[model samples]
Target: MKKVILRTVFISLLIFSCKRKQVDIPIFSYSILNDSVKNFKLNVNEKEPIIHYEYFHQKDTIKRLFFKYNSDKDLLISNLDTFYFNKKTYNSKSLQFKFYQKKEINSHKRFLVFNKNYGLLANLAYGSDYLFLKDSISEMDKKLLFKALFYDLNKIETD
Candidate 1:
Protein backbone atom coordinates (compact mmCIF):
# COMPACT_ATOMS: atom_id res chain seq x y z
CA MET A 1 0.00 0.00 0.00
CA LYS A 2 2.81 2.46 0.73
CA LYS A 3 4.57 1.55 -2.55
CA VAL A 4 1.36 2.18 -4.52
CA ILE A 5 0.91 5.63 -2.97
CA LEU A 6 4.52 6.56 -3.65
CA ARG A 7 4.28 5.47 -7.28
CA THR A 8 1.11 7.55 -7.73
CA VAL A 9 2.81 10.58 -6.28
CA PHE A 10 5.83 10.12 -8.50
CA ILE A 11 3.70 9.76 -11.62
CA SER A 12 1.75 12.91 -10.80
CA LEU A 13 4.92 14.90 -10.27
CA LEU A 14 6.42 13.62 -13.53
CA ILE A 15 3.29 14.59 -15.46
CA PHE A 16 3.25 18.07 -13.97
CA SER A 17 6.94 18.62 -14.56
CA CYS A 18 6.73 17.62 -18.25
CA LYS A 19 3.85 20.01 -19.05
CA ARG A 20 4.57 22.62 -21.70
CA LYS A 21 5.03 26.22 -20.65
CA GLN A 22 2.49 28.76 -21.81
CA VAL A 23 4.10 31.66 -23.74
CA ASP A 24 3.32 34.93 -21.93
CA ILE A 25 3.46 37.37 -24.83
CA PRO A 26 1.19 40.39 -24.55
CA ILE A 27 -1.74 40.66 -26.99
CA PHE A 28 -2.23 44.02 -28.67
CA SER A 29 -5.21 45.79 -30.26
CA TYR A 30 -4.33 47.34 -33.63
CA SER A 31 -4.79 46.70 -37.33
CA ILE A 32 -1.94 44.52 -38.51
CA LEU A 33 -2.18 45.06 -42.30
CA ASN A 34 -1.24 48.12 -44.25
CA ASP A 35 -4.41 50.11 -44.83
CA SER A 36 -3.04 52.67 -47.25
CA VAL A 37 -2.20 50.48 -50.21
CA LYS A 38 -3.63 52.05 -53.34
CA ASN A 39 -4.02 48.95 -55.52
CA PHE A 40 -5.11 46.31 -53.07
CA LYS A 41 -7.52 43.68 -54.43
CA LEU A 42 -10.90 42.73 -52.99
CA ASN A 43 -12.33 39.26 -52.62
CA VAL A 44 -14.90 38.41 -55.30
CA ASN A 45 -16.14 34.88 -54.52
CA GLU A 46 -18.22 36.15 -51.56
CA LYS A 47 -17.63 32.82 -49.86
CA GLU A 48 -13.94 33.49 -49.14
CA PRO A 49 -11.51 36.41 -48.89
CA ILE A 50 -7.83 36.97 -49.58
CA ILE A 51 -5.31 38.44 -47.12
CA HIS A 52 -2.13 40.55 -47.27
CA TYR A 53 -0.08 41.91 -44.36
CA GLU A 54 3.22 43.82 -44.16
CA TYR A 55 5.33 44.75 -41.16
CA PHE A 56 8.11 47.35 -40.97
CA HIS A 57 10.33 48.14 -37.98
CA GLN A 58 12.85 50.98 -38.20
CA LYS A 59 13.82 52.15 -34.74
CA ASP A 60 17.57 51.55 -34.50
CA THR A 61 17.60 49.52 -37.68
CA ILE A 62 15.21 48.27 -40.38
CA LYS A 63 13.14 45.13 -40.63
CA ARG A 64 10.63 44.15 -43.32
CA LEU A 65 8.06 41.40 -43.18
CA PHE A 66 5.38 40.38 -45.63
CA PHE A 67 2.68 37.70 -45.56
CA LYS A 68 0.28 36.73 -48.33
CA TYR A 69 -2.55 34.27 -48.70
CA ASN A 70 -2.66 31.80 -51.52
CA SER A 71 -5.42 31.69 -54.14
CA ASP A 72 -7.22 28.76 -52.54
CA LYS A 73 -7.39 30.71 -49.28
CA ASP A 74 -6.20 27.78 -47.22
CA LEU A 75 -2.47 28.56 -47.19
CA LEU A 76 -0.22 31.41 -46.07
CA ILE A 77 3.23 32.44 -47.36
CA SER A 78 5.38 34.67 -45.21
CA ASN A 79 8.70 36.44 -45.93
CA LEU A 80 10.67 38.03 -43.13
CA ASP A 81 14.10 39.70 -43.00
CA THR A 82 16.03 41.44 -40.23
CA PHE A 83 19.50 42.94 -39.82
CA TYR A 84 21.53 43.11 -36.62
CA PHE A 85 24.28 45.67 -36.27
CA ASN A 86 25.81 44.25 -33.11
CA LYS A 87 26.56 40.92 -34.73
CA LYS A 88 26.75 42.39 -38.25
CA THR A 89 24.60 39.52 -39.35
CA TYR A 90 21.48 39.33 -41.55
CA ASN A 91 18.79 36.83 -40.70
CA SER A 92 15.58 35.74 -42.41
CA LYS A 93 12.87 33.13 -41.95
CA SER A 94 10.14 32.09 -44.33
CA LEU A 95 7.21 30.04 -43.17
CA GLN A 96 3.97 28.69 -44.56
CA PHE A 97 0.77 28.10 -42.60
CA LYS A 98 -1.97 25.76 -43.70
CA PHE A 99 -5.35 25.71 -41.93
CA TYR A 100 -7.52 22.71 -41.34
CA GLN A 101 -11.24 23.32 -41.74
CA LYS A 102 -11.94 21.83 -38.33
CA LYS A 103 -9.54 24.20 -36.55
CA GLU A 104 -10.84 27.56 -37.73
CA ILE A 105 -12.26 29.91 -35.08
CA ASN A 106 -15.14 32.31 -35.81
CA SER A 107 -15.14 34.60 -32.81
CA HIS A 108 -15.84 38.33 -33.04
CA LYS A 109 -13.06 39.48 -30.73
CA ARG A 110 -10.10 37.17 -30.26
CA PHE A 111 -6.49 37.28 -31.38
CA LEU A 112 -5.41 34.56 -33.82
CA VAL A 113 -2.62 32.25 -32.67
CA PHE A 114 -1.15 29.22 -34.43
CA ASN A 115 -0.26 26.54 -31.93
CA LYS A 116 2.12 23.82 -33.03
CA ASN A 117 0.06 21.05 -31.46
CA TYR A 118 -3.47 22.50 -31.69
CA GLY A 119 -3.36 24.58 -34.94
CA LEU A 120 -4.75 28.12 -35.37
CA LEU A 121 -8.03 29.93 -34.74
CA ALA A 122 -9.30 31.64 -37.91
CA ASN A 123 -11.02 34.82 -36.72
CA LEU A 124 -10.39 38.03 -38.69
CA ALA A 125 -11.85 41.53 -38.61
CA TYR A 126 -14.62 41.26 -41.20
CA GLY A 127 -14.76 44.80 -42.56
CA SER A 128 -11.14 45.84 -42.77
CA ASP A 129 -10.58 47.32 -46.27
CA TYR A 130 -7.10 45.91 -46.76
CA LEU A 131 -8.37 42.48 -45.86
CA PHE A 132 -11.32 42.70 -48.26
CA LEU A 133 -9.14 43.75 -51.16
CA LYS A 134 -9.67 41.13 -53.84
CA ASP A 135 -6.86 38.62 -54.51
CA SER A 136 -5.12 39.58 -51.29
CA ILE A 137 -5.97 36.76 -48.89
CA SER A 138 -8.75 34.43 -47.94
CA GLU A 139 -10.91 35.16 -44.90
CA MET A 140 -8.94 32.65 -42.86
CA ASP A 141 -5.58 33.95 -44.02
CA LYS A 142 -6.63 37.46 -43.13
CA LYS A 143 -7.20 36.38 -39.57
CA LEU A 144 -3.92 34.52 -39.37
CA LEU A 145 -2.00 37.41 -40.90
CA PHE A 146 -3.57 39.80 -38.44
CA LYS A 147 -2.17 37.85 -35.54
CA ALA A 148 1.17 37.16 -37.19
CA LEU A 149 1.69 40.81 -37.98
CA PHE A 150 0.50 41.88 -34.57
CA TYR A 151 2.83 39.45 -32.87
CA ASP A 152 5.80 41.17 -34.50
CA LEU A 153 4.37 44.68 -34.73
CA ASN A 154 3.56 44.84 -31.03
CA LYS A 155 7.22 44.29 -30.28
CA ILE A 156 8.06 47.43 -32.21
CA GLU A 157 5.06 49.43 -31.01
CA THR A 158 5.63 48.76 -27.33
CA ASP A 159 9.39 49.19 -27.30
Candidate 2:
Protein backbone atom coordinates (compact mmCIF):
# COMPACT_ATOMS: atom_id res chain seq x y z
CA MET A 1 0.00 0.00 0.00
CA LYS A 2 2.84 2.39 0.87
CA LYS A 3 4.67 1.70 -2.38
CA VAL A 4 1.45 2.11 -4.42
CA ILE A 5 0.63 5.45 -2.77
CA LEU A 6 4.18 6.73 -3.43
CA ARG A 7 3.95 5.72 -7.11
CA THR A 8 0.56 7.47 -7.49
CA VAL A 9 1.88 10.72 -5.97
CA PHE A 10 4.96 10.60 -8.20
CA ILE A 11 2.80 10.06 -11.27
CA SER A 12 0.49 12.95 -10.35
CA LEU A 13 3.43 15.30 -9.84
CA LEU A 14 4.97 14.30 -13.16
CA ILE A 15 1.74 14.90 -15.03
CA PHE A 16 1.30 18.30 -13.43
CA SER A 17 4.88 19.33 -14.22
CA CYS A 18 4.64 18.16 -17.83
CA LYS A 19 1.56 20.32 -18.53
CA ARG A 20 1.99 23.09 -21.08
CA LYS A 21 2.31 26.69 -19.99
CA GLN A 22 -0.11 29.44 -20.98
CA VAL A 23 1.02 32.04 -23.49
CA ASP A 24 0.03 35.71 -23.42
CA ILE A 25 -2.30 36.89 -26.19
CA PRO A 26 -2.66 40.54 -27.07
CA ILE A 27 -6.04 42.26 -27.46
CA PHE A 28 -6.17 44.45 -30.57
CA SER A 29 -8.68 47.10 -31.72
CA TYR A 30 -8.86 49.74 -34.49
CA SER A 31 -10.78 52.55 -36.24
CA ILE A 32 -11.08 53.70 -39.89
CA LEU A 33 -11.72 57.16 -41.38
CA ASN A 34 -12.39 58.43 -44.91
CA ASP A 35 -13.64 61.64 -46.49
CA SER A 36 -11.16 63.41 -48.79
CA VAL A 37 -8.02 61.46 -47.88
CA LYS A 38 -8.10 57.86 -46.61
CA ASN A 39 -6.85 56.82 -43.17
CA PHE A 40 -6.62 53.84 -40.81
CA LYS A 41 -5.94 53.75 -37.06
CA LEU A 42 -5.15 50.71 -34.90
CA ASN A 43 -4.64 50.43 -31.15
CA VAL A 44 -3.44 47.56 -29.02
CA ASN A 45 -4.45 48.01 -25.40
CA GLU A 46 -1.43 48.91 -23.22
CA LYS A 47 0.58 49.56 -26.40
CA GLU A 48 0.86 52.31 -28.99
CA PRO A 49 -1.70 53.13 -31.71
CA ILE A 50 -0.84 53.14 -35.46
CA ILE A 51 -2.23 55.38 -38.20
CA HIS A 52 -2.04 55.12 -42.02
CA TYR A 53 -3.06 57.35 -44.93
CA GLU A 54 -3.70 57.28 -48.71
CA TYR A 55 -4.75 59.83 -51.31
CA PHE A 56 -7.19 60.05 -54.25
CA HIS A 57 -5.99 59.31 -57.79
CA GLN A 58 -7.50 58.36 -61.15
CA LYS A 59 -4.56 56.15 -62.08
CA ASP A 60 -3.55 52.93 -60.33
CA THR A 61 -0.67 54.64 -58.49
CA ILE A 62 -0.74 54.74 -54.64
CA LYS A 63 0.75 56.99 -51.90
CA ARG A 64 0.70 56.23 -48.18
CA LEU A 65 1.82 57.36 -44.71
CA PHE A 66 2.06 55.25 -41.54
CA PHE A 67 2.47 56.52 -37.97
CA LYS A 68 2.44 55.37 -34.35
CA TYR A 69 2.08 57.12 -31.00
CA ASN A 70 4.73 57.13 -28.25
CA SER A 71 3.97 57.08 -24.52
CA ASP A 72 4.06 60.86 -24.50
CA LYS A 73 1.55 60.99 -27.41
CA ASP A 74 4.29 61.97 -29.84
CA LEU A 75 4.01 60.67 -33.40
CA LEU A 76 6.48 58.42 -35.18
CA ILE A 77 5.67 58.48 -38.88
CA SER A 78 6.98 56.41 -41.77
CA ASN A 79 6.28 57.48 -45.35
CA LEU A 80 6.18 54.96 -48.20
CA ASP A 81 5.67 54.76 -51.96
CA THR A 82 4.38 51.79 -53.99
CA PHE A 83 4.45 51.94 -57.77
CA TYR A 84 3.90 49.43 -60.55
CA PHE A 85 6.30 49.45 -63.46
CA ASN A 86 4.10 47.17 -65.58
CA LYS A 87 0.52 46.01 -65.37
CA LYS A 88 1.38 42.34 -65.96
CA THR A 89 4.38 42.27 -63.65
CA TYR A 90 3.97 41.08 -60.07
CA ASN A 91 6.99 43.04 -58.86
CA SER A 92 6.75 46.67 -57.66
CA LYS A 93 9.09 49.39 -56.41
CA SER A 94 8.89 50.82 -52.89
CA LEU A 95 10.61 53.71 -51.07
CA GLN A 96 10.60 54.25 -47.28
CA PHE A 97 10.94 57.33 -45.06
CA LYS A 98 10.92 57.12 -41.24
CA PHE A 99 10.33 59.79 -38.57
CA TYR A 100 9.74 59.24 -34.86
CA GLN A 101 10.49 60.46 -31.34
CA LYS A 102 12.78 58.43 -29.05
CA LYS A 103 11.31 56.46 -26.16
CA GLU A 104 11.92 53.53 -23.77
CA ILE A 105 12.68 50.18 -25.36
CA ASN A 106 9.66 47.91 -25.84
CA SER A 107 8.90 45.05 -28.21
CA HIS A 108 6.46 45.92 -31.02
CA LYS A 109 5.79 42.33 -32.07
CA ARG A 110 2.07 42.46 -31.37
CA PHE A 111 1.75 45.72 -33.25
CA LEU A 112 3.11 44.05 -36.39
CA VAL A 113 0.46 41.34 -36.30
CA PHE A 114 -2.30 43.84 -35.67
CA ASN A 115 -1.13 46.07 -38.50
CA LYS A 116 -0.92 43.39 -41.17
CA ASN A 117 -4.32 41.94 -40.34
CA TYR A 118 -6.23 45.20 -39.84
CA GLY A 119 -4.35 47.67 -42.03
CA LEU A 120 -6.71 47.22 -44.97
CA LEU A 121 -9.41 49.22 -43.26
CA ALA A 122 -7.29 52.32 -43.75
CA ASN A 123 -7.18 51.90 -47.52
CA LEU A 124 -10.93 51.43 -47.69
CA ALA A 125 -11.54 54.57 -45.67
CA TYR A 126 -8.98 56.88 -47.32
CA GLY A 127 -11.19 58.11 -50.13
CA SER A 128 -13.80 59.50 -47.76
CA ASP A 129 -11.23 61.15 -45.53
CA TYR A 130 -9.53 62.71 -48.55
CA LEU A 131 -12.76 64.55 -49.19
CA PHE A 132 -12.86 65.60 -45.55
CA LEU A 133 -9.20 66.68 -45.40
CA LYS A 134 -9.81 68.61 -48.67
CA ASP A 135 -6.26 67.95 -49.82
CA SER A 136 -4.95 66.48 -53.03
CA ILE A 137 -1.87 64.30 -52.46
CA SER A 138 0.58 62.70 -54.88
CA GLU A 139 0.64 59.03 -55.93
CA MET A 140 3.98 58.62 -54.21
CA ASP A 141 2.27 59.15 -50.86
CA LYS A 142 0.07 56.11 -51.42
CA LYS A 143 3.04 53.88 -52.16
CA LEU A 144 4.93 55.13 -49.15
CA LEU A 145 1.95 54.49 -46.93
CA PHE A 146 1.75 50.78 -47.79
CA LYS A 147 5.47 50.20 -47.43
CA ALA A 148 5.70 51.85 -44.02
CA LEU A 149 2.67 50.05 -42.64
CA PHE A 150 3.72 46.58 -43.87
CA TYR A 151 7.33 47.04 -42.88
CA ASP A 152 6.37 47.99 -39.37
CA LEU A 153 4.00 45.01 -39.16
CA ASN A 154 6.72 42.61 -40.30
CA LYS A 155 9.19 43.94 -37.73
CA ILE A 156 7.25 42.61 -34.73
CA GLU A 157 9.53 40.63 -32.39
CA THR A 158 8.63 37.33 -30.76
CA ASP A 159 10.52 35.76 -27.86
TM-score of each: 0.29, 0.21
| Model 2 stretches astray by more than 4 angstroms | 21-26, 31-149, 152-159
For all candidates in order, the CA lDDT equals: 0.35, 0.31
**Ten contiguous residues minimizing lDDT sum, candidate 1:** 83-92
Model 1 regions lying over 4 Å from their true place: 32-96, 100-113, 117-125, 128-159
lDDT of 2: 0.31
lDDT by residue for model 1 over 1-159, one digit each (tens)?
999999999999986665443332222222335533223211111112334443333231243334444445444445532111111111114333322222343553222333222222222334531222223444465566555544542354332
Q: Write the per-residue lDDT of candidate 2 for residues 19-119, one digit (tens) a residue.
A: 33322222111222322333322222222232333222323235323433232433333343222111111112332222222233243211211122222
Give the count of colliding residue pairs in each prediction: 13, 29
What's the C-alpha lDDT at position 1 in model 2?
Answer: 100
